[model samples]
Target: MNIEKLDLKSPDLVNENFEKLATLFPNCVTEGAEGKAIDFDLLKQELSHAVVEGNKERYRLEWPGKREAIVTANLPTTKTLRPVREDSVDFDNTENLYIEGDNLEVLKLLQESYLGKIKIIYIDPPYNTGKDFVYKDNFSKDAQEELIDSGQKDEYNQRLIANPETAGRYHSDWLSMMYPRLKLARNLLTDDGVIFISIDDNEVHHLRKVCDEILGEYNFVAQFIHKNNSNKNQANLVSVSCEYFLCYSRDLEVLNKEIWRIEKKGAKDIVKAFNQLKKQGLELDEVLDEIKDLYKRPKYAHLSRWNKIDEKGVFMDDNLSREGGAKDYTIINPDTGKPCPIPPRGWAKSKVELEKLREDNMIYFGDPSTPPRIKSYLTGEDLSVPDSFWYIDNSIDTRWQKQTFNSLIFENPKPLELIRLIMEMSSAKDSIILDFFSGSATSAHATFQLNTEDLGKRKFIQVQLPEFTNEKSEAYKAGYKNICEIGKERIRRAAKKIKEETKADIDYGFRVYRLDSSNMQDVYYKPQDYDQNNLDLFGDNVKSDRTADDLLAQVMLDWGLPLSLKIEQIDVSGKKVFKVAENSLYACFDSGIDEDFAKAIAQDEPLRIVFKDNGFKNDTAKTNVKQLLKQLSPETEMKVI
Candidate 1:
């Protein structure tokens, strides 16, 4: 009989790293004082040319708890994600996910399944201001128990204020809280994926250095300045209306060094005008006059500068010469019949490119003394590249967020337009976007909103720690006990509003999973500690309090199948059976399972099958079942717990 390892937890990363290194350089891998340790002296010799040794002043970011934080990241947790079906929206059919838990442990739990799979991760972590809060890192303590004792087991108050400026381990504590989470988050990113972290002045500098070390300094994308607030409060020495988003790519080279941009809202009217004129069967000149009338509107004043119109639509003239790296080129103006005067920095386009543009009628030569310029069309993929600095006016700031909730449920909630812009630039249709620090679920709302606009099927995973709301706060009075409540309700309200307003067929649903202790019982583990006589007293190995659905969820977690997949229950001759993701896995948790049931299930040619150890009436029945499965479905992997 095979006794499967019953403990479900994150893998031991240190040994995994050693094994990977051993695979790469087997000669350098030798048995040491400790079992299966890397021979560093030999490894350094093998990589002699590239190794950097000693305390020889190399650039690095360090904090007191850095090593401990790394250990915490590498340390495995036996926690599992427990599905809360009652809290979910369209539980079985949705691709969206809402995980309520400590993000550190949650990140570890997701590492194996989601490794190198996510397309975008946008997190708005605590800025580490004295007023802000960070999770109290206590890996040894039972997090669930602590939450229960603190009256937060339902979804509240696991966060503690890490008020810096007075505490000895002020910065170190905050760094410790963020370091491991960031490391595990990087593991979840695809090769070309990108991460955006929001921070304020308090921790932006420190956060940058930490991200540089973890994500690599070369992968650094940009530190985008967001004008988050519209009203200027003369509260401090300098008006602090801006926040920053530090972006980094998993692999810049693989991204093709190219990123998409969001279409400017100011250009929507121009597109509408073009469509209207086209419907009227107007010629290019006739359309120009109508479009010119549109440009006269005060709201469309920005389009006034883009006056030139042709079959290519509205365009603005751009100087041939670039700012710094301009090339010299000669362009004979057709009107003057002579080479146009070159600008101070020479031409922006090369000779061949200039000739091509000229032939394509993209250049204008209206005057003799004036330098010729390229006509940049204002239609088609005329998306605006996000500037290093940007402003989101109050009008676009959480209109739906507040209108749906009918109250201000979250303080300083990120504007939906802001995250919509981020997702548009970084994600493709069907991309998975993860936001670990999903305060008020703005990212989730934005993902839904954008999908409706473009008809793209982008999914999202939102993780929040259930930080409690203040007793006197508006959110608390409005019936939101914690941040998770606010977050989930926001998505529900936002989805309803979007559906009612746009009539778009969008998947604005999500499955809810909460972090909890593993479903396996104490007897399953420490079997060696207990005698067979005493072990029998516990009866079944699985926890008595756990239901069949709980066991199935644990199995899904172990198999790395997404929790959002459809599940169906069927009966096989008085035994209950569960099928996950159609053919991906089949499981039976009912007792009295027999060879007949196994043979019946094997007929479907399932990829994997699992059973409870005591589910069979006898050992002979279990043995016969295995043989039957092997004969019928030789490729099926059978496991018992």
Candidate 2:
């Protein structure tokens, strides 16, 4: 009986791609020195109907390090995420996650657990304005070390390099950095998923081409223009007062065409006010007068036409005439007991539909003289398709951020309304939203606000690198030594404010995890390099300073389980056991494991189980435990670290 050891690494995407291609074209697969490899010559012939040409010229977006970027994305990582209990809000119960690390490594670790699970992704990456720094992926460590030796990188290991305009590879470096991260992000989206990227004029054209290549040009949705600032008078050429959001869908055909609508501006406030007046038992005349007065306010003035009310609700008189003259129909007015005049063009609805509308009290006639108009109820006609242009004041967001933290800790934080608008139009009530470039956690803040408004179950996953703050900046002075500190604090403040103001019963907590080296010792991965002289040196495979919680997290990642699942600690026969998601998995890292504890745990019949390699009292005890589980709980799949 063989007990398998868990592989503590991410999925090798290159091997998986080869296997997929082999399944599709068996004749094009051949065994190579490394293993099964694709014969590109034969594969090209198989895909083309005509004779294929070698090194044919084609239109493509490429840069100096494009190939290396592709290779980086296909490679697997040996890193793991260690939970930070002291920094987390509610570690055991919350589904939201806040991860701190290099986003490239973080995205690779999340490939298996969150594949095709996220519904919406919004990122506000560095705009590459020649002053801001871009992520240095360290494709070649020698090059990175050279940069560090030259004083390019700070001593804190921020993994960022400034791309000045004078640099030879200004655009190339930025493109290479964004390529692999976008490629990895695409794998985490569902069929109907969409991504929105906030960019500026500095690199919008290049970024658009990169997205078109990765997400396919046919899936391009729209380029929304946001007039965020209107007072930029310091431009040498032209005053650029706006930025852009490039939107793309994973599969355009899978999205519902009608789902891109949002409630009209100020519609919710109008409904709330109307409902309040009616609940007070005001007379119909008094209610109409009060509603008219409410619409006179500057905020609700645009919807003044919907001032009339009836037993159903507030409504506006809409023209019943069709533009091109549809079926003509007339009906008698109930108030005047006479037939109303017909519209010149014709009624929009057919005779049968018109009769149904009259029965439902959806038509209004004035004294039987004017043509009858349809009554468009506010409740039924409140939604409208969002436009491609948005005009929002930037100072409002700055003021709100100041109020939230009681200080301007972060610079140029994304507006909460902008993220909330994107989420409202793209996501569902119970969707998972991800922001890999979450600088100040605005995406998570938006998720909490939206869920509070509708009592939704939306969850968010925020990923950011712990870049050091400038010593002269206000954030550094406020004791926020890194960007991650500001982000986590902003989330806590936002959640508290929303809960206190609305008394919302939603998930107001998040679990914090930081990227680190794997829990396994070097010998566990490279046993072939050791000889008999040093064989006994590694009595245990796990590192000395690592804890059981670290081991459990890596095990969950290796087994393709989400880190947000519930975990329960159990004590049985003087040993500790972990039960995850009830019966989905069971793990025990305790020593002195015997047949009695195995029998006790086997009775639960968990689908999967894991144990430490040296946790048993003796070799005989380990063998006996395996055999006992095979007989007692035959369905349970067991493994060891």
Candidate 3:
């Protein structure tokens, strides 16, 4: 396939000033192609600023189907990695899934069962490091009915070809690669969804723009500063210390707090309360302020007046909220070794306040032995100050992207802790989380972990290209041949970890699929003048081993439609295609798209009808397809396998 790259400089590149700086994988950023790699340095010049582009939150693609969401008891369309039975893919039994094929296609395959469902999605793609890109061929300009004609796409891509150096449109290339995929990812997130992207200075800006465009600019949550590489070599300028985590959410409002909270060491009041009650049988309030020198706070009990505590939580009353209360008070200054004078109004406890204090038994002197003092237990304010910044150490590096980019796998990859942190504060557990550039499968990891903690059944759908690895890299040694390989392994490992750790009885693994040709093979059409039996138009006619999602793509193709069209898998019917341009087509490859099924499909006045030739045992009935087409749908075009 001849790959025609557009202009070297993406002229209308509104996101950033990309003319400056060097890059590791130049192809990752470009114009009129997949996408532009982000410039992490430029994007993080300041935490709030980055190269901005189109509205970050607005999506370029509008989802087409909403009606056919249910899954049916039986399906006759294409093959999918669906659970044959409820227990087939038990949420509690297995922790990982290794799906073969394209990530985009897989995302489509998963749309039905896992919408707004994943907790995290981590992916490490071809950094567009020109030498490592490996895009599979789907078709070409020629009248090619088939290429590989297999489920697996050949490994003929950029890795073998000369690397395309970073061009003037550096960021453009990476942006193009990310945009559409990100749009698709948006659908798979739970409300409290979070996405984490791992990128250096090269194309961070482009990522931010793309994220903002698809995830909503308002959803730009936060960027975590991560030390990606520990620079040891000396340089002319400052050694770059970190990578940025581009984060966003499904919805920004209705966020929750306390999801990522760690209980602080017991507050001082807690210790005092427990010790006083258990050891002394005395309420803290009963003897808190009876008699102690201003400078003698640490050893007040040494005075020995309150030798034995007899009560717990027992206290003298203080009338603070009462009208005209707290008329008398004693003020002491420890530093000055003196007492501050009472106010002209006769201290906070004036005559009126004094009378109230006496009634509540709120005053004491010479410690508890002489008398008990008032203790206001109600004074505990909502005053625990949470640190504004999350400490890097507290962030759990999840098991994702461990073996990617050769020897560059981040061991103990940063977990979706960062994602969870951002997501919990801005989304409900059910919001969608779109992570276009998933690396190390962290987003998915975080989502799964969060689900166990949340107990709220949220779903996730991930999209990642099959970015190959350098066989010699350290990551490859750890057992991954490509970035996608690592991604799959991480999901599996995460699943296992979750199952063992949480023992959840709910479903979690994603139904895996990938981008590919339709499951239906190129129709073996005979010339119009041929006189042999038109047996092709019979039942069970489909690519013998293609995937269900692929078959859906074929349905679009035979009907002259775009492969990217939306499809829904219903519980009662199997796969349903919608937003059908020009007309509608219902196809099934099951052994028999029988008479009952045919009639079922015809329930709607579709524009066209195509089915498996094997489904019709009666030749006469097969020929009646044209007549049926006229009656069931006058405008419908009917044909057989």
Model 3 TM-score, all chains together: 0.51
Please list the residue runs of candidate 3 whose C-alpha ends up more than 4 Å from where it truly belongs after superposition. 1-166, 186-198, 210-219, 224-236, 249-388, 394-412, 419-436, 501-510, 524-540, 547-614, 619-641
TM-score of 2: 0.78
Candidate-wise lDDT, in order: 0.81, 0.85, 0.47
Residues 72-190, candidate 2: write the lDDT tens digits.
88889999988888989888788899999889999999999899998999999999888988877765576467576435544334578888875657778888899999999999999
Off by over 4 Å in 2: 1-57, 142-157, 229-233, 268-346, 350-381, 524-536
- Per-residue error at 491 for model 2, in Å? 1.3
Candidate scoring better on TM-score of 1 and 3: 1
Supply candidate 3's per-residue lDDT for 46: 30
Tell me the lDDT of model 3 at 340. Answer: 41
**Please, what are the lDDT tens digits per residue for candidate 1 over residues 33-56?**
233457677687688787656445
Ranking by lDDT: 2, 1, 3
Per-model TM-score versus the true fold: 0.78, 0.78, 0.51
RMSD of each: 13.4, 13.3, 14.0
